[model samples]
Target: MISMSPLLRLALLALVASITGWLGGRCRADVGDFAPCLPVFYRCWPPKGLAGTPICQRFGNQYRFATMYSRQRRSPWFSGYLYTVPTGRRPEPQLAYAEADGNMVPFPPGPLDQKVLDSQAVEPDYINSTYSRGHLNPSLHHRDHEDRTSTFTLTNAVPQKIGSNDGPWEVLEQTVNRTLGEYCLGEAYVVTGVIPYQKDERWLRDHRVAVPEYLWTAYCCPDYNNSLPKELREAFPTYAAIGRNDPNSTEEIVPVNQTAKTQFRGYDVRRMTLDTLETYLKDRFTTAVSVFYERCSGS
Candidate 1:
């Protein structure tokens, strides 16, 4: 048999050590504000009171991205993934559920049992439902085929309205791709998450997954080209947006457009600076939702 290289052996040992440490004790379900293990290239901006399992998305035995998943809602609160200009064609959608540390076995397309991994949303959760399976870390930001494919997991999705998913939200995602692809000289870190209603919580058809009222996304790019178009200013370093998921909701945050087409109405996306986004989040969540450290600034 061929011998393992020194670097490979060290990596294997580290992975074994991490697994042992995680399995050594009882898993805590409370929101203790513990930092989850992020991929080597990622930046952490974990929100408060996010009581969920932190999943380092593994695809083909390689770490693809990071996500903070909530088993209670059976959806991800947010997913942090690095952004790179597209070099290959987009991969076909192959959705699957995450097998958390071997907690979920016999993995196949079917209903999820809460007892196994505290209830993960599966393909059936979206079937015939009014909402679409919206991805937090969209596939368009990655360059590798596996990275794009890894984004199809149900754990990284939320119950998003079709209007928002296909309308302005999609435009915003495409705009980000173009902007970063052209100006950003270095890696871009994107954190996309959802906001719950103030009082009444919405759920899917089967009531197995919770639906978000608004989808919020923020990006931190430390290095970027200084010569940006006047219209594209305030985009570098950090920027954020909040998209409306409910048509009947109030217009205080994201106002609905009455003159727009019937299908795309009320799914407006309001873009703003990072501080303004946090203000809205603080008011909505009743606590500070810091998306980046020092707003990704360097003095």
Candidate 2:
């Protein structure tokens, strides 16, 4: 170590303070209400309302971040997929926006052209023995034409269950949408997906594999009904989540349900700070949000 005179030491202190101040300013400027993350997820600005809603389009590999809710409301199957709905169903674009890529591949082929084969009429040949033509993302959550159609793709699908898809699981999806739409006020960014099959998992057939043993979700309400009366918050608490529910399920499947309020596959519901939400999205959706703006144009 070197010793310095009192006056020299004072000068060094001043220099250090100046450098610290400059760095703080740079950090604040570089991070203005938004940040980025990859691998697990991504983050963008707070979602907007119908009027001038922000379009955080998910494109490229990040498209996979769009969660799968239910492939078909009528069928008992659910899975995961990568797709995008118009940021807003408005006649025109919001003109100002930001986005982050979610995990998965990019270059999404847009919503599934129902014409590829009538989803209502017949299941396609692609519905092979290995997998069921499951809907990764549920169609009910989508309020617009594009969102509904985008959900029909083979990629936005997974092998799920008739019981889960058609029974309790389906009820859960609808209940979530209604709860959010009513409480959050039109459109909640709900990303739902599956856990996929493990080697130990049994298959319905040699081909039709067992769907996700559980579902995972992370919801954020950065600006949840700021205008609502404070007292009503409990009736409409803006934050919640769960891991898995072996509770109330068949005794063979979920054994701990007799005393528990709900089963826990991995239910971890709690309010998240803005910073946490950003980190969550960035970690979940690794690619950028690519807004799909057009209707099906090709055959």
Candidate 3:
């Protein structure tokens, strides 16, 4: 007969329970604000944590939370469409891509219950005390109904600098949307979010932290012939670059520092499949992660 120490038995039990919990929390139908946009559809908020857990429960799709993301950190709760708009068509007006509506939707206020709390708090790895919510995958990128509507999920959020959000960040976002609008065809699944804040704490109290000094983007176009030359092929080569909104920042790019700002930040872009995106996210989040998971994987 094998004898196991009491502590060892308890630790093993905890691990098994955690795995079971994560499996149970897996999304059903990808419902809520995070549900995938099928064809040309417009809706707010997926069923539940499918759109990341941060702010999904706060408000459906009307307004999005700052740092609380849909999936990736610091990005908007992305929900966009891939459809055609008829001439003289009218889409309902909504808040600005960078600004909040100053409205707080109802939810159980105060500290959420342990179960709900677990799903609600931001991850510690990327989460910080003073940084403002920054957006990587800007809401502007989702121009059409399908993609536009999904940006409200909480999972796509992260801490960011106000300067970053209101400055170069905006530039990167607009450029991506405009360029994609100008070129590319078929569907574009853009997954963007902030790189976690490094040690020094870039964000000032009550101020924002600049997200990636350089924005990174990966896109794929299976049917991209309408805009560019036919030689471009269905798999359009992706793009990545360094950009600076502030003239005072450095020209040499690197990861952002907590106490200082860099002028140039390197970006990496490539073509990736949805499966690849999911795999990447799992590694970043760590464990069998979900919007509601309690573990904070931030380094």
Candidate 4:
């Protein structure tokens, strides 16, 4: 979903805005702003204070989600989308190995990239790498065939450790699904991002992709049933969480549970107030990072 000439880009944006295509076709446009895809956000408001290139994730000729991507880090800063109650089993991720400007059929690793600017390319960077292709806007959160498949794009992923991707973090996602499916009576908006290590940051074997120290997610559901259980009363209209991606990381952010099962022991996910998550995000990015508008006020 984004780069081209300024005048040409503006013309294309105008053209795409006027033309509507079928859900089975392809029409992608990488915009400088979120002007055309405001529906993906809650109350038509995207998160503010984080910096990255904007990608209107257009798949099957439709805008399904938005991704804020980092060129230098070659990973997504965050992905924002509207959530629906999911059905059926999860499908395989249809990894797009294309160069950002166009799909590189057979995707030769030799051709250099432009626009999306992973010159080293995403596929080559992760070959035999220790990390997993963690989805910032995961498939487990969407329902339609195209919506689920749209979440598979490379621009929407990051380098995540196996423990964090498949452990408590996975459980957290499922919990959110159950909670939202049961309580949320209207549209639910979610934004998931990463917290990179401030010092001595880790990299993949090729150093082409940066690995995050933590993965953060928050959801806003302003409309919901009033009969929430006492334990889950405070979970809406907003709730946030941060998961540890490094087992060796200190316990200050997310303390590791040492006595847990072998696979899930060190990778802990901490659920906290949205303000608390933003506080840590601000501290890490050295700027005020807001996840939801007015902290997802239901008023």
Give each model a TM-score: 0.83, 0.40, 0.42, 0.84
Off by over 4 Å in 2: 1-42, 45-134, 185-187, 196-199, 203-210, 226-299
| lDDT for residue 138 in candidate 1, whole number 0-100 | 91
Angstrom error of the Cα, residue 297, model 4: value is 1.1
Estimate, for each residue in 136-219, the C-alpha lDDT of model 2 and write its tens digit. Answer: 466665555544544554445545434344544556665556556655642234444443323455443333334445444434
Measured on C-alpha atoms, candidate 3 has an lDDT of 0.37
Residue 204 displacement (Å), model 2 = 6.4
Q: What's each prediction's clash count?
A: 1, 50, 41, 1
Highest TM-score among the candidates is held by which one? Answer: 4
TM-score of 3: 0.42
Candidate 4: the clashing residue pairs are 2-30
Q: Which 10 consecutive residues of model 2 have the lowest summed lDDT? A: 290-299
Best by lDDT: 4
- Show the lowest summed lDDT stretch of 10 residues, model 1: 25-34
Query: Quick one: RMSD of model 2?
Result: 15.6
Task: Name model 3 segments beyond 4 Å from true.
Answer: 1-116, 121-130, 144-150, 197-215, 226-235, 241-299
